[model samples]
Target: MTISNDLFTRAQELIPGGVNSPVRAFRSVGGAPFFTKKAEGATLTTADDKELIDFVCTWGPAIHGHNHPVIRDAIAEALNNGTSFGTPNPYEVEMAELIIKMVPSVEKVRMVNSGTEATMTAIRLARGYTKRNKIIKFAGCYHGHVDSLLIAAGSGALTLGKPDSAGIPEKLAEETIVLPFNDLSKVEEAFSNFGDQIAGIILEPFPANVGLIFPTDGYLQGLRDLCTKHGSVLIFDEVMTGFRVSAGGVQEHVGITPDITTLGKIIGGGLPVGALGGKAEIMDHLAPLGPVYQAGTLSGNPLAMAAGIASLKLLLEGDAYSRLDKMGKQIASAIASTASEIGLPLQVPQVGSMFCVYFSEKRVDTLDDATATDTDRFNKYFHTCLEKGVYLPPSKYEANFISTAHEQGAIDRASEILCETLREL
Candidate 1:
């Protein structure tokens, strides 16, 4: 009597792969995905009426936990005012002001419907401002589904890019240069060959797409310096790390500010929202101020703005981030210790409330390193934890998130289950 299985059967008839998002299909972990009926605090009640301690946190937006009273109340209140006015709203202005005040790099911000919209718009603005067609991005850093950025490496180190997806023209991909993560030398080489034509370099400061990989010492600072030296904008795609890593995002943590920043996830307060912000000079290249054009009918939806304000206001109060760091360290240390005791090859990388467990003997510093992890072992562990009432991210490539609502007791229970699972493995 698995409700999730029944629903999944029905979903397959209505949606592609029985899921809207590919990751949600549980293809990586090899199982039918859990259909959650409700979520509160730090737990999710699946359609089968099973309660599990949630670690994904809705892919890093549930910092205050799912259905937080403040955010829910705000959404309910906004519903009374109606949805989608298709015009300027005061809530949008308030959300923008909060972002500018909190993020050191964002002087002004424009709202879009999703992270993809934000990254796409930021790249277009960069090209328009610098009058350059080429852009540089690191491998495994997913900015969105932009065609120009959808490129894989060619045969050699210095070779140009090839289309990772069909329909992306080779000419469009040529404008994008792909490089290895944390390799400053490759970045230099790309700039050496096409620096003048390179409009900007975009990347995730703390990449979470392929597990949690932090930038090497001075890696981010080097990018900032290089972009400044080359007169090209540096765009930090903080869509995943935005408020999850720290209140000011990873830019604040690293002390290296980018010329432009793209944000999503927590900023939307669990709704569909994305933003691109930066120095006035670059942002002015968008819309009425410059030739670059970007528009969205539901860009700054009032409901999303209200929820965002509520969430940020809560984060701004007192020591939320400190608590999050404490919790993150506790979980990482516990899992690491357990893996060691059970003779499991585990590499746990953590920052603030985000963490990832890579089942590999080698340290995971890049996508290539992360890919080397034993997925078969992880798949076994994933199901084991799921049976023990602990919910983790389905893919090894995705990071686990903790919320302010996750208590010490929940962590202890999850850690004990993980330890037992490792021993069994």
Candidate 2:
């Protein structure tokens, strides 16, 4: 048996589902998940000693690729000082300052340990600020497994076919109004029906968790306007898109401001980090300034702050986003052109370095369309590509990421492998 198979056998005894995360179990892909021994530049060395050209990019944080020297050095430097202080540190202040400077809508920012924490706090803060109980979330937008946000969520929850997790109170779920993404009319209807009760509306602006669906034309702006008209807070869940899509994120790219923005992934530079930022008036509603209680001892740990600063600085150094976009187009176009040549029904939705391949001919713009993607074919394609030394997200309902380390050669090689795999299938 392969080392990964052996490892899985042992892991299942100790860890639930043989993995820390649900998708890592490879249940959707029908295979043993390979554990990574090490990673560098756009590749992961599997436990079986195979080097796979990684397209998962550690689920959207490896913008500079794994084990980047710059980030490593920053972490090492921070380590020299200390790991955790429990008291406020300089790195936290600097990190918050950097976020305020970069994200246009974020005037004040607070750090947390994970995207879940950031999002959960944002919800509470919004409710506290608006003095309302209900929150509106898109059907497939995963806001980090917060109880109320778990209904009709995406990511592993979608992959496992359990959008609504068990053990969450029914009343909590009811307070979260799940709506179809990219549909402004439904949003308007929700507001008209429960305008005074809506504390906020949280969305992934681009909805990367459910396979990278984009907003319809003027759809985001329409949400902004509706939120304003209803006196509800607008929360952009950029945990996946922030800093990775652009320096200032989708808000900066699209020019629509949000009252609160939740960020993680690249902002932490592959470390466990998350942040919530917004207009000072709303942010001040959090504890110490207002009634919303949110606190984390490990929040803004020195190592994460240092790593994030290095990652953001590197992104700012050159035309990184442009380069990433160019590379993204190369991979995306290759997949599209090949699928067309082979008469395969494929739709590749891409923005900046994030994209997903839907094995359907129809354009995917809503959660319904993304949910209708062909998983059987995607599983077959995933295994074939992995056998050929290319690794993508294990499930069809996840976004594939590209890193700065993925140059033209890697892109070309991955494209060829993807095309050949498609042709064979």
Candidate 3:
């Protein structure tokens, strides 16, 4: 009956902590992670035969929900043609064009396998083009596990990143200056101290990795202006927010364009795809054009491209974003009202379809505020929701997602469960 325990017993012998990813171990919550067998629409059928209303949505890729027929059919059609060619394909060009059209700031784009690769390539391209060595990243804004960007990694690595990973050299960490999120004074000070040597400033414009923290008014524009003044590249790591926040991502929503933007999640349509895009002049710095070398055998894989095209097509079909905004507001309001009724200290930060429920009395505006949350209370809430057949992101530091598949019924049920859970807690 305990499927997660059995799977963990077997997986630990093969994979580290019984998961390819660290957070799946359920370490923060102190429980066995459910082994998912199948998923359809907004629900995940676990190996134990439990059907849960999935809110994590595979950590943001299943924006249209799991096993979407259009995306699946596209992948199947691609599989019939061939798998990998390790060469150019028409789908690659189509995917690139779709990205260029959808994201306003991505004038040119290069594909890779994961967000880590996209960010790594973006940083490399900035360094190559600017001929500078230093980079700036904000605390608790995770841009994947890339060595140079690990100074204050969030999500799964947040608790263990005090020393910035075991293998990353101190010299590499020294090159990265980690500052507070949403703090313009710290950003200005960093630039003032090392503006000449800094190649780029990279951050998650919304800071979703440590929960959904929004930028202060004019904060993103300030970054753009500062980067322009200092002759440094501004890279918005929108792996989580790219397509989820709006059709054009956070950059368009905020009316500020970064020099580079890293995308993943919804753009890939639940596939393993990532891209870094920016001005053609800077993108040309990559290999086959300039000296910055970046290559991926599976970059622009046909199946991924097919699924992405299908997903993007579906997203472009109607006023889907307006629907997403409505859903986000509905769920956020429901949860907030319930929390207030129960006198539970909670803060729900939401943007579009992504949100995080922080078990804190104070408003969460920065990474420090996020860390101050009562994670112990969150673990209790998570287990309670899980027992009620609702699945949320396992860690308090992560965001919960809603997909097009989630209807009012699911949202209401989830809100009721959360309310009961908080009351019990």
Off by over 4 Å in 1: 152-163
Give a tens-digit lDDT track for model 2, residues 1-425. Answer: 99999999999999999999999988888988999999999999998899999999999999999999999999999999998999999998899988999999999999999999999999999999999999999988999979999999999998898989999999888899999998888999988899999999999998988888888899999999998988999999999999978899999999999999999988788889999999999999888899999998999999999999999999999899999999888889999999998899999988899888999979998778887888889999999999999999999889999999997889999999998999998
Q: Assess every candidate by TM-score.
A: 0.96, 0.99, 0.98
Residue 154 error, candidate 2, Å: 0.5
lDDT tens digits, residue span 1-425, model 1: 47789999999999998987667888778878989989999999998899999999988889999999999999999989999899999999999999999898999899999988999999999999999999999887877778876664211111111227678888888888888899998999888888899999999898887788988898898999899999999999999899877788999988889999999889888999999999998898888788999999999999999998999999999989999899889888988998888787899999999998889998877767876789899899999999999998888777899998888899888878877888888
The order by descending lDDT is 2, 3, 1
lDDT of 1 at 108: 85
Cα misplacement distance, residue 231 of candidate 2 (Å): 0.6
For model 1, where is the 10-residue window of minimal lDDT? Answer: 154-163
- Tens-place lDDT per residue, model 3, 246-267, is 8889988888899999998776
Stretch of 10 with least lDDT, candidate 2: 366-375
Candidate 3 has its poorest 10 consecutive residues by lDDT at 157-166
- Better by lDDT, candidate 2 or 1: 2
Evaluated with lDDT, which candidate comes out highest? 2
Pairs that clash in candidate 1: none
In model 3, which runs have C-alpha deviations exceeding 4 angstroms?
Answer: 159-163
Clashes of 1: 0
